[model samples]
Target: MSPSVLLRWALRDSARGVTASWIGGLGYQAGLILLPWCLGRALDEGITPGDRSPLLSWAAATLAVSVALTGAEFAMRWWATLAGVRTGNRLLLRLSERVLGWDAVTAHRFSAGDLVTRGTRDVEQITIWISTVPSLASGVLGLFTVLVVVATLDPMLAVVGLGTVPLLIAVNLWYPRRYEAANAALSAAHGARADAVEDLLSASTAVRGLGGEQVLVERHHEASATVHDRTLALARIAAGWAANAPFVPWLATAAGLAFGGLAVLDGRFSVGGLVSFASWMTLLGRQVMMLTFRFGQLGDAWTAAGRIEAVLSAESEMSDKATSLLPAGALATDGVSVELPDREPLRLPDLSVGPGEFVAVVGPVGTGKTTLLRLLARLADPSTGAIRYGGTDLRDAAIADVRDTITIVGQRPLLLSGTIAENLRLGRTELTDGQLREACRIAGILEHIESLPEGFATEVGERGSTVSGGQLQRLALARGLLRGARVLLLDDVTSAVDARTEQRILDGLRELDVTIVFATSRTAVRDRADRVVDLGVHDGELVSHG
Candidate 1:
């Protein structure tokens, strides 16, 4: 979606809250005019005329207005908050789903840290804007009320009223654009810094092992300094606008008061009319001030909205259709080609697997083994390829249907932060204790789980860091098997484990009826595979063994 489209949706979602906030500000602004009128009346008929009765009555009226304004203010705030919170949630969820739906190669194309930043930090910026932005509309309404109140008291003062508003508008529009440009720079610098930090965090051990702390630290400092300069530039713009706004109003109000005083003395204006002019000028000054503040908020929101739009606008690698059921235990790939940007495509010619058949992919590094496996699993699509299940092409097949029949365990296994049983039951919610235990046993992770204090309930740290690499791989295998996929793609899963462990895992998988396609660097490993295809590169293009 475009930035404009995203913002339109955001506004619609938060309309109720935004409206509430507007109402609250209007009520407070109404009190601005009413309180001034009450004071002017008391001065004219009570204090100046030495009438105590009128003073007491106007005092009670002021108190009642104050109470009502307070309620209005609170009510508006409550609703605005409600709207903002709900909008944030919906946008967050929507953005997250889009990002996660993208393919592995596509997902990795964007920085993980930047995505996290957009989801969180960038999202926060809009909330700040919402809190202050609706005031602009309310302030305009308040200005109108002030002008009418002045016109009723004296038509002469109303003639010069709002003379400075055009100039104020020009300044508000100009300053915010400048502020936002600087903020854009600031946001870019911060996102770069986040990417750098995430890179370092993920490779902290490697960096420390290689004694590259200084290099990382220097890179971090450079990123941080750029962000600091951009932030200061944005602040400067805001400061300039804020400092100048008040002065413009001061000049306008001063001109009105001096001219207004003389007109009254000349008998062209009344004492009560001059009182109204003073009140309107005060109200106008505040309105101008609020106008400047809202401009800054909108500028900030515009900046944030653009970044969020970029992420949400990102298209998935390929569109997935609605879920449709495909038959069980069948797979095929016909003249598949895996295309990488700025690189020649990798080819797989006519590979098929029957129900209960085990197949393995063997090739050199950079060969199409892993790529072929990825295609079969639909983790990534093959350019100019036909992947079919039973008699239907996978492209025509519902995405969920394709996924339902195939599960892949990648070279580097990922385990969610959960107990062993919880991780195994990820895809299958209906797994019984016996079934869960059986899958774990088949994957050879049952012994490891039994060693832990909590057995199957033992907590796995973030990404399964609490377990050994061997254990993580085993857990992944258990998850795939428990899903009962008719086909399983194993991509160098044994790379982190010993030969004994690898043999045992393979032995268990060998007895399964489901197809198993494994990629391995060693010839010995491939020899044991049910079927092996050597990925031979000729003329910088790949050809499989016939």
Candidate 2:
């Protein structure tokens, strides 16, 4: 999507709030114009003639207008803030939805830190533009209001006010493109720095083992230096423009003062009219300054909008037309092949497994064992064949239905910072406590959990740091079992456990009435399976044995 389309989408999402904010801004600008006019009326009709009663009446009118202006300004601010927050939230939701639906290959294109920055810092940049819209609108309306009032006071003074408009327009047009380019560069640098820092922290152990801490530090320093330099360049441009902005309005004010004063002396203008004209010119100056600042914000927002659009516009791997329900039976792959970028294609022989059979896939490292499992799980699509379950192509079935029917446990178990029960019920929240414990028993983790101080209520630290590696794997197994999927795919899930523990876990798994496909290199694991598929000697082929 283009930046314009992205901006339009954001506006559409927050249309109601934006419309209300515009209304409030219009009212605020009207009040601003009226305040100076009321003061001028009091000076001309009452104060000048020394009429105490009329002067008192006009004074009270001016005070009332000031209070009204304050109220209008408050309303404008409130509405603008509401619009900004709502738009930011909507964008965040849309980005998250898109990211969640992406296939593994598509997701690998973005770093975790980059995605976070786009969802947070980039959204905030866009919100800045949305919030500033009302102010920009009010300034524009006020500029016109001032011009009309000044023209009424004296046509010559109106010409002086009008002179600033073209200059301001020229400055706005020239600055935004340059400023936006600089801002985009700075944003890129910042995202890079964030990614480097996140990587360093996440892999601190490996960095220390390899003694590459200095290398990572130097990389982060380079990214930070780029950001600092870009920021300085952007600041210089802003400073230059700001220094010139005040001069436009002040020059107009000087012209109005000199000419309007002479006009008053020539009996063509009143003293009150001259004072009102000067005040209007000053107000116009302030409007120009506000618009200049908003224009800069607008430039930054455009850059951010483009970045966000790139993510939103990416093609999703899942098919929207896949609405058929997946049936239960045998699983098969026909002429399956996967071709990754710059890597040789992995082609598998035609294979089939009966429903409820336990099958083990054994292959050497880099033999595409995990890739085959991912294909079967629909985490990726095969480049050249179809994966079928129960005689129906998975491509024809709804992705959500297919995923609901299959559970995959990766080599590395992932657990959130929550109680053991909480993690077990993540996939199926309606599971009773008895069911949770039953699943834990089936995964051979019940005794371990019961031995803990809090039993099932024990808190797993972030990423399951509180648990041992083997325990973490067992917890992941229990969570998957709770889902009760028809098919279970495990990728070296028992690698961390001892042989006896691994045998016990396998024995428990064999009792379940479900199809199991596990990849392993251990002879004990392969021997336990009802059938085994060997990928170690056939190049890309699969040789099966019972």
Q: Which candidate has the top score in TM-score?
A: 2
Best by lDDT: 2
Q: What is the clash count for each candidate, in the order shown?
A: 1, 0
Q: Estimate each model's TM-score.
A: 0.87, 0.92
Q: In model 1, where do residues sit more than 4 Å from their true spots?
A: 48-51, 131-133, 151-160, 256-280, 322-325, 340-344, 416-436, 454-457, 507-513, 521-529, 536-546
lDDT of each: 0.75, 0.83
- The RMSD of every model to the true structure, in order and in angstroms, is 3.8, 2.6
**Stretches > 4 Å off in candidate 2:** 48-51, 265-267, 317-320, 341-343, 417-422, 427-429, 450-459, 539-546
Q: Residue 366 in model 2: shift from native, Å?
A: 1.7
Instruction: For residue 323, give model 2's deviation from the true position in Å.
Output: 3.9
57-144 in candidate 1: lDDT tens per residue?
Answer: 9889889888988887787677766776778888889888888778886687668877887888778767666666566777778877
Q: List the residue pairs that clash in candidate 1.
A: 356-513
